[model samples]
Target: MMTTMIRVVLPAHLRTLARVESEVRLDVPLDAEGRLTQRAILDALEARYPMLRGTIRDHVTQQRRSFLRFFACAEDLSLEPPDAPLPDAVASGAEPFFVVGAIAGG
Candidate 1:
């Protein structure tokens, strides 16, 4: 069976840190069925982009890092559960999964 693929865009720093040239590609399971979560996707992403092992979440605790954020459809999903269903564009493979860094300085 062939699963749909999704394009995920990482922060510039992460991309450079991960040493990836282009966006990351993820394989959506056949039965995902609108369950656009970040955990599985993140896992798959890390598996593919080994250099990004601990960019989003911690390697040991698996908890989201300090300033990492997940966004889609112009909404912030950093607080959303990793297994939560993301926007249709993301699930449908139209948009890209974004892992951005949060900056808090005035």
Candidate 2:
């Protein structure tokens, strides 16, 4: 299996939980078609940082947390399919995948 080095930027709380001072670097394996996706990245992330298991997504359902959003190349990927290919910039390590904490107000 081929692996790619992916950059993932976590929210402040998650960064603290993972004990990471800055963005995380994960070696993510590509699928059979040599495609990189969000699931692959998150899988590798959780594998390396076990403490973040349920913080980013639901452990059982594997769904993203309601307060979290995904962004890459200035695009919102939160509504995209997990298996969808990320932008080339993100895949090439030119940009970081951002896991941002959303804010809501009354």
Candidate 3:
């Protein structure tokens, strides 16, 4: 197994909740057959920062929170399958995975 560094950007509220001022850097474990996906990233994020465990995803179902959105390489990844491999740029750390808070108003 090997570890790869992944960069992540959290929304302001989440950052405050996690007590982080800058982008988060996580060392994600990768096996020979493991593909870099949203599920993998979220698992690593919650593992490294337990405070964020249920913040981004449901603890039981592991589903993304409804009020949050995900993005990578300037594309909306919110509706993508969690197990699908993220963009290469994101997996390579060339682009940061983004979690943004969604706001709805009339």
Candidate 4:
């Protein structure tokens, strides 16, 4: 299995939950087509940090949590297809994938 190291920045709460102080570097595996996707990144993250398995996405439905958002290269990727390839900057490590916890108040 071929793999690439990806940089990911988690929200403060998640960072605390994962016990990581800085951005996380994960060895994400490529799919059968030799392409990396958001699903692959999230899968590798959960695999490496078991505690984050269901925190970012639903364990059963695999849907991103409503309170969470994903971004890369200054673009919002929260609604992007899971199989879609991330931006070249993100794939090449020029930018870090951001997992942000949304805040709402009135």
Question: Which is the leading candidate under TM-score?
Answer: 2
TM-score of each: 0.83, 0.95, 0.89, 0.93
Say which prediction, candidate 1 or candidate 2, comes out ahead on TM-score. Answer: 2
How much is 91 displaced in model 3, in angstroms? 1.2
C-alpha lDDT of all candidate models, in order: 0.78, 0.91, 0.85, 0.90
RMSD of each: 2.4, 1.5, 1.9, 1.5
User: Distance from true position, residue 100, model 1, in Å?
Assistant: 0.8
Model 2, 9-63: lDDT tens digits are 9998889999998899888998888888999999999999999999999999999
Q: Provide the clashing-pair count of each candidate structure.
A: 2, 0, 0, 0
lDDT of 3 at 74: 90
Among residues 3 or more apart in sequence or in different chains, the pairs in candidate 3 whose N, CA or C atoms overlap within 3 Å are none
Q: Write down the lDDT that model 1 would get.
A: 0.78
Using lDDT as the measure, which candidate wins?
2
**Candidate 2 TM-score, C-alpha based:** 0.95
Model 2: residues >4 Å from true position, as ranges? none
Q: lDDT score of model 4?
A: 0.90
Residue-level lDDT for 69 in candidate 1 = 82
Model 1: lowest-lDDT 10 consecutive positions = 28-37
Output the better candidate (2/4) by lDDT.
2
Which candidate would rank higher by TM-score, 1 or 3?
3
Residue 19 local lDDT, model 2:
95
* Model 3, span 61-95: residue lDDT tens: 88888988999999999999987778878877899
| lDDT tens readout by residue for model 1, 1-106 | 3456888888888778877767877796534464656777887788877888876899999999987888877898888876777777887788888888777662
